[model samples]
Target: MFDWLYVLMKKLVENVFGLSLDTGIGDSVHFFFYDSVKIIILLGFMIFTISYIRSYFSPEKTKEYISKFNGISKNVMASFLGIVTPFCSCSSVPLFIGFVEGGIPLGVTFSFLITSPIVNEAAFAILWASFGWKIAVLYVVMGVVLGVVGGIIIDKRKLEKYVEEYVYEMQMNRPDIEELTFKDRINFAKSNTLEIIGRVWKYVLVGIAIGAAIHGWAPEAALTKYAGPGNPLAVLAATIIAVPLYSNALGTIPIAEALLMKGVGLGTAMAFMMATTALSFPEMVLLRKVIKPKLIANFVAITAIGIVFIGYMFNGIAHLVI
Candidate 1:
């Protein structure tokens, strides 16, 4: 789909810039320009389309819809809902409280919280654009599975006592759902696209710059030695390293692309991206408001274990996909 852009960037680098593609500096410049443009374009289009679809599913409607289901199916719905809602980890907290206030199960709410940041239209589109459909599909499947499994485990453990008492006592005033015309939906989509792009564009640039630097100057043998498929601890190392860093999936994909290019194992790169986006420290602080320390720790431990398992699973099957 973006073959033209690649050719154009190559031409611009070698011709307009008068730099040989053989040089590391030239190659890095090309990578920075090509990836930055491609991702930005994908971000704009996908965000708009997803935001349009999301206009129909307001918070009230989402809460009401999820409340109707029960048991495992409820968790399933919540996980799927999380994919379309497109909330960042910190942003998802208020809704998390709303779910509890609405009498939704802690486990089901966790399902939504877990998946909301990790899987979304932007992430899926970027993955498909950067890698391929197979990887994109696999990522979505794995993310949803993580959410469902995490939610179920939390529910089975009977962790409701960990929630703050004030959350239950707080009565949420339900707002009436507004009926939107097609025009309204379009306008909302446009605004949302701009808002999201404006907010994350810097992260995108910084991520791409890091990726370009790694792509252009990093020693492949060194990366392969530490992060390659041969290293059994590579995935675990990546996940642990990513815990302190925070970025959305969109920002992390380019870095993952560079890591893969530098001979890093696919699973290792993905684990880093997932850990950064899903279990960010800011998200923990936000959740601390409504839940106690024990619950937060459990959530982190459960989710981290799940991510590590997924990272290893992806490594095991890397050959089939790559």
Candidate 2:
């Protein structure tokens, strides 16, 4: 479907600018244009479609629905719900608090928190576009599993004491939800599409620019030597390095693509992406407003371990999928 975009970029680089496709700079420029345009178009369309579908599931409605479920089923439902809601880590905090106030288990709330930023529609669309459906499906499945497992661990540990006392005492006032017509839903989707694209466009450009540079100039030998499948610690190093630096999955996907092209191990690149999106420092800071420090630490530690495990698993089976 996007072959024309690649051909057009090739012509623009080689014919219009007189740069040969054989040169590194020419290939880098083509990559930047092709990926940037392709991601933007895919992002816009997916965000609109998702926002439209999301219009039906308000936070109030979601809380009510999840409240009906119990045990592992609640965690599973919450994680699946997280996939449809396009909240980044920090943005997910407010809904996290709402879920807490609504009497949802801390573990189930954590499930939603973990999955929302890591595996939304935007990430799925970009992954499918860049790496084919097999990898995209794998990513989504892994993300959900991580969420569910993390939630179960937290629940099993009975870590509710780590949550702030005020959270339990505060009463939540349920506001009336306004009914929307078809046109209203369309407008909401349009506005949401524009809002999200406006927010993440710069990240997309910067990510693609970095990816382009790596695509054009980075040494394959160095990448393979350090972060390749042969390096047992590659996934661990990737995950550790990613925690302090934050970006949404959309931004990180391009870098992941670049790393893959440079022969970086599949597990290492994915671990980096997951840690960047899900274990960000700013997110921890925001989460601190509601939860105590120990719970925060537990959340980080559990989620990080799950991400690393998934990374290794992916690396082990990469050939079968790729």
Candidate 3:
């Protein structure tokens, strides 16, 4: 099983990036690499399905109104919306910016931001179709829980005060932040959807490469050695393992599959994948361009803790029930 996962991940990285590292199985890699390309093409079709649907199906006026909710209700609401709304990081920043500029609460915005990338339509569809409704439902609920709790934690830390001075000055409480007209709403959604997909395509490919490699070559022994049952430090270790790698939204699929195949605990693998990819180094760098370091630290700390909790929570539940 370990060898199978390793072969899957290694071939993925090679094909996506044109990288050529020996997985010590020269001839076999060629075959897996071919299949990996098919996987990439399939994922591309799926990612764009969500992206274009956001353009065709959603109205901008509604988003404009919802974006203004700016409170805890809005946070959960945004999380729920994030489950279906297709967005990548770059596209999301502008939506996030518009909300902030329009005076939405930071915590509510965070909820939307976190959940959108982690719980896209493709993710739900994949889990639902492949795993079953129970797991799919659990995935959505946990995603919302992560976003809502993480938002509140960030808010309570008074981290809003740490937004870059420019962003701070930009906050408003205008009564006029209402829904847009139908034409304007649809146009807005379409534009934002396209912009987000365009900006994130690169990140997705990069993510797929890393994920593919992990799938192709990660050692089962290492997974069990580091994250197996009875390991009390597993959660923290998982977080630490995930910090340097990065992916966003759709890119996590291959990596997660590979790790799971290797006997890594669901919670631990998820914690690492979520932290490294969803709230990534590049995203932090981009955010720091707009937010203060203190705010960044707080954001990182909150999400990291949230992911760790998720890691343990799912692990405990899985063991108890299964």
Candidate 4:
């Protein structure tokens, strides 16, 4: 399907602009157009569909459903819920407070928090569009597993003591929202799709532009020499390096794809992506408004461990995908 689309795009570019797809610049242009179209279409459809489904599962409903589970099941459910639930880091702070005050386990809430940003829908769409179903599935599975493990680890540590007193004091009002009709749901989905597209399209273009430059002009040997699997610290270095940079997973997917093309280890690229999306320094600072320093440290430590594990595991089995 992609090849057919690429050929069609190539012919269109050639006929309309008199540009041959055989040259380096032409090839890059072809790549840019084909990937952009493919990703945009996929992203719009995915966000709209997910947003529609999400209308039926409000935060209140999510909390109610999650509160029913116990033991590991609770963590697992929380992790999965995080992926499907719609909330950014800022919104999550209030929700976190509400959950803790409402008797949701601190660990389970943490599970949701960890997975929510890490396995974002935009990132999922970009991964599926750029890589394929296999890589996309792998990313989601790893993200959910990390959330479950991280939550369980926090639960066992009894980290509730580290939660700030203000979190308990902060009250979230559950406003009575009218139930949405089918038309309302469709409109909501449409608005959400447009909003997401407007926000991320620039980032996508920037990322893909960088990717095209690297793919068309950069030196493969130089990249491989430092970032390849043979380099013992490559994955660790990438993860650590990515922690401070602020970027969404969707924006970074193109960069990761470029890195893979340049012979960077799959594990290294994935670790970098996970680190950027899951635990940036700014996100930690925002979280600090609700969680104590000790709890924040624990969150970073456990999440880092899981991300590193994912990195090494992918690098070790990279042949299967790369």
Task: Score every model by TM-score.
Answer: 0.93, 0.93, 0.66, 0.94
How high a TM-score does candidate 2 get? 0.93
lDDT (10s digit) by residue, model 2, range 1-322: 8989889889899889898877899889888988998988888888899899988877677788889998899999999888776576556667877898888999999998898888866777777767777998999899999999999999999999988888788787777778999999999999998987898888878888999898999999999999988898999998998887775556777888988989888888888878877887888888898888999999999999999999999999988988
Q: Please write out the lDDT profile of model 1 over residues 1-322, one tens digit for every residue.
A: 8999999999999989998778899889999999999888888888899899988877667788898998899999999888877476656667878899998999999998888888877677677767778998899888899999999999999999999998889887766667999999999999988987888888778879988888888999999999888898999988998888775556777888888888888888778777877898888888899999999998999999999999988888989998
Candidate lDDT values, in order? 0.86, 0.86, 0.63, 0.85
lDDT of 4 by residue, 210-232 (tens): 77667667788999999988897
lDDT of 4 at 20: 80
lDDT of 3 by residue, 135-243 (tens): 6567778888888888777767776777766765665443454545667655665565456556555655554456556555677788877776557688788787677
What pairs collide in candidate 1? Answer: none
How far out, in Å, is residue 107 in model 1?
0.9
> Which of candidates 1 and 3 reaches a greater lDDT?
1
